[model samples]
Target: MAKDMLNAVKDRLWQWLSSDPGFILNHCERILFMNEYREIERQSSALEKMQLLLKIIIEKGDDSCQSFVDILRIHQAHYWQLQQFFKPNTQGSSSPTVVADGGSVVTAREMENIRAKSINMKIETVSGAGGSQCGNSTGQNPQADYIATGGSVICADKICNTSTDGDFNLSVTVKASTQVCPGLVDETLPSSQEPAVKMIRQHKEKLVDCLRSDCSFILQRAQVKELVTDRQYQNLKDISQSEQTVIDLIDRLMSNGQKSCTLFIEVLKEPEVLRTYPQLKDISWC
Candidate 1:
């Protein structure tokens, strides 16, 4: 069964790859759009492609095909390594002490001393106020800190915190590069809504500008087309009216034969006189 599956898979891949010269071209656009989702699409797509190759081997049913399968199997062992960055809640533990081979040791005190050495650490100005998710990092709570002053909020500050739970004393230095949470957004704080609302208003302004520009461009193009079409219609109408006038004049002259005969003789005599006077023939019609 596995052999059949592998053979089928390989055939499918070969077919897809060979089907169109432009198939790979379409994937370039997908790769660009995938950037918005923070590269998750890229990782998942790679895994799927690898799995398809495995299916191809099972369908082949030959001992020689096992070589490719074995190679893939080896590569699969490092799946966790590739997936580590995308894994959630894998941030390093805040606990000071971890259990060693024989006994438990305190690392929390040591970490605090590390924080006390201002000479070693750099100062940064954090923008946001309270506890919330940082831009690319899972967020830590600001109020949970014990110290709230000087842009340095110690995680031990929250009222709910207990002593030496190891979760406490996770001090954060609000550096200039740090992504700040706007504030604590609870029922009690009216100020929490300000930043969110302001952001919405800004977005609305941008949308309005884009829409206006698009409308202006469309209106200008439409006006030009309308002007050209209107001019063409008026010109055609004028030409048709002038042709009708000529037809009417011709019909009148034909109906009145005597009058038409007199006018034709007069016109013929005038051209003959002009021919006799060479200077008159060359003169302006007006």
Candidate 2:
């Protein structure tokens, strides 16, 4: 029957997607702590392991597996960016760590979704559930809109489309702090050096924490529908070079301003850049 064939096709799609190679690599990366590799050789080995696992996963040709592969590939690309730090051939001014602008910086919701998918990806590899299997949260809500007719279907787990019906809760938090500038010998008392380095370290930690928290809150408050307003979506879909540059420039300026905000006494006392950039709340580059 047509309905039976459609169901079979969908099951095949889900199986392939669930075992996505990229998704599997992410799981391996986390489980093996490949992220901790300090040398190029070690890192290369890690990459090799990842590649092998991915190849095997892809060959399986299941929908869920393919989905896993796609997710893993994305995470692996991120790992590749980190590998530059380990390249042995690169010389001069080498440090133990490399710092970049850091990506969109995932929101808590996104973070949870990634984490949930990661666990599920790993379980899929072991279970070999083949047809379809659901474990861990994917941050998708079962309550999400669905269409159905008069029919009854169930899985061995006694659940229908359980994998698609999940929800994630990401709460927001904020904190405030103040500290004297570090490395400063009070102009009035040149002998005062006790607070310099200590204050600087404290400030740096506080600044990073504050920025992370604010960014998370902003992302949570953002509404995708509002941001992708139909008109804007069309324009964004076909953005011009000039438009892209303007967007990039604005983002850099925004980050720069926030980075320096810690230098401002009042801003440091109670940081609030997110309040101004509410659009950042729900938008993700991916």
Candidate 3:
């Protein structure tokens, strides 16, 4: 039962990464070697890229996962979901968020065990006995670790707890009917959980895709709304690179806490600003 729940949490984590694969990848850069990162980046498939990323997190074990989460700065609401899986009274207390370094991060084995489940997580649709396995190349066993376990009492499909008596095996299968965690799509976060920051974080890739033409206006609004200090605004306004400027902007906003993020959301809502970034429209303050 515990393993299943753990895997469910892991599955949720992977699916959450899907929310902003590029952003997650960017944070991952902080932990990866240039060569290792290049290898994952070359995959060309976001799913596979995510797979490789999770694999590395697993290989890096507990500490690296902690670092990755800190580097990502996961939001409190999402962190609450993880709390469900890491109940304090349970033996799994150290499962993901361990008490260390004044903060918490996930365990790498969580990534490892969950990846093998192949719960699909909306990646592919497979029905019943028919499922696609990850491909291989050049006499290599790339799919070796992801093959679905046969004959084990454990069933990875529904993510339920089942005790089995047999040697352990591993595999992955992709299918449509696979049940993903509802938390990914449902669950209302508490009002204080910085929804604005979550929104900005989720869209950070788009905001930083280029030096947005609205960069100056955003700074103007930030200054007007008192969201950024004059010094901070001038520093960001001076940066020529759109990417770093936007990244810094987000970092600063999130650092300032919920009120700043709320004002930042307002900046994105201006008629002219929304004209440049339509997706950011209809947003309410966090």
Candidate 4:
């Protein structure tokens, strides 16, 4: 039963982590805080604790959990070495430490630092080599080198061999292909909106007024009811029941043959309505 409960909790935690990648950091922080404060009891089994610690380390994707990882590695290796024919060194030294196999004596912290330094050295070496190669390649392309030095490449280029500085003279000419007339461009521009958008934009004010009036009427009626004693309060049910009335008001206000139903639906989906009605927060417009 205990193992089943642990598995269930682990499954739920994994599901939450998979749903939101950003939640892992918060989850790890919460777990660490709980462990520190003893808000939750620790696992009895070392293997269970190690499993949880490994999961947290994988989620963290950083060196913050290196100590715990090192501890687990040391325990696993020592366990295996004890069963082998050639056992590892377990003799205590005068300096209060014992050397493991291969005659190396280093603490987990020192090993971690050494690994970090080696990684940094490798990265720096690769970056320096790449930079030198890029520099040489760019130097071979005169046009690219000129652009890299803040010179713009435009239009036609004529290369002239000169005897002075052993450098070729590059002549570039830039010219506009056509003049732009504002009036002609404006007349030629295609309209982005369809006929429905144009109709909505033209009659937006009338639609807004109609909606406001319908809401006021619904509020007045709702206020008159004995159950609704508060005149200022309105709930989601009130708005839902009066939806048809608001739609009818919009239809009456809008011009005929303008696909006004879609326009009204769009108006209802506006940000202003959502802000005004907090109860409609969960409504899916799509």
The C-alpha TM-scores of every prediction are 0.15, 0.15, 0.31, 0.18
- Among the numbered candidates, top lDDT falls to 3
For model 4, the superposed segments whose C-alpha errors exceed 4 Å read: 1-167, 170-172, 179-195, 214-286
User: lDDT of each prediction vs. the true structure?
Assistant: 0.31, 0.29, 0.51, 0.33
Q: Tell me how many residue pairs clash in candidate 2.
A: 35
Over 137-228, each residue of candidate 2 has an lDDT whose tens digit, in order, gives 22322221111111111111112222323443322222222322233224322111223322333344333344443333322222131321
Number of clashing pairs per prediction, in order: 27, 35, 8, 0
lDDT of 1 by residue, 1-286 (tens): 4355446555434333222212221222222221221232222233343343334334445553555433334432222221211233523646322211111111223233222222222223454433323232212212211212323323221133223422333433444434334433342222113343223233433323322322333223323433213332232234334433223222222222333323422332365433533343333322
lDDT of 4 at 272: 65
- Please identify which of the two predictions, 2 or 3, would achieve the higher TM-score against the true structure: 3
Where is the poorest 10-residue window by lDDT in model 1?
97-106
- For candidate 4, the TM-score is 0.18
Q: What stretches of model 3 exceed 4 Å from their correct place?
A: 1-193, 278-286
Better of 2 and 4 by TM-score: 4
Model 4 C-alpha lDDT per residue in residues 1-57, reported as the tens digit of each score: 323333434544333223222122223433354332121113332234335544554
Model 3 agreement with the true structure over 7-106: per-residue lDDT tens digits: 3456666654543345455556557764565566555444666677877776776677677655544532333333333334534444322221111111
Q: Candidate 1, residue 81: CA error in Å?
A: 8.1
Candidate 2 ranges beyond 4 A from true positions: 1-44, 73-286
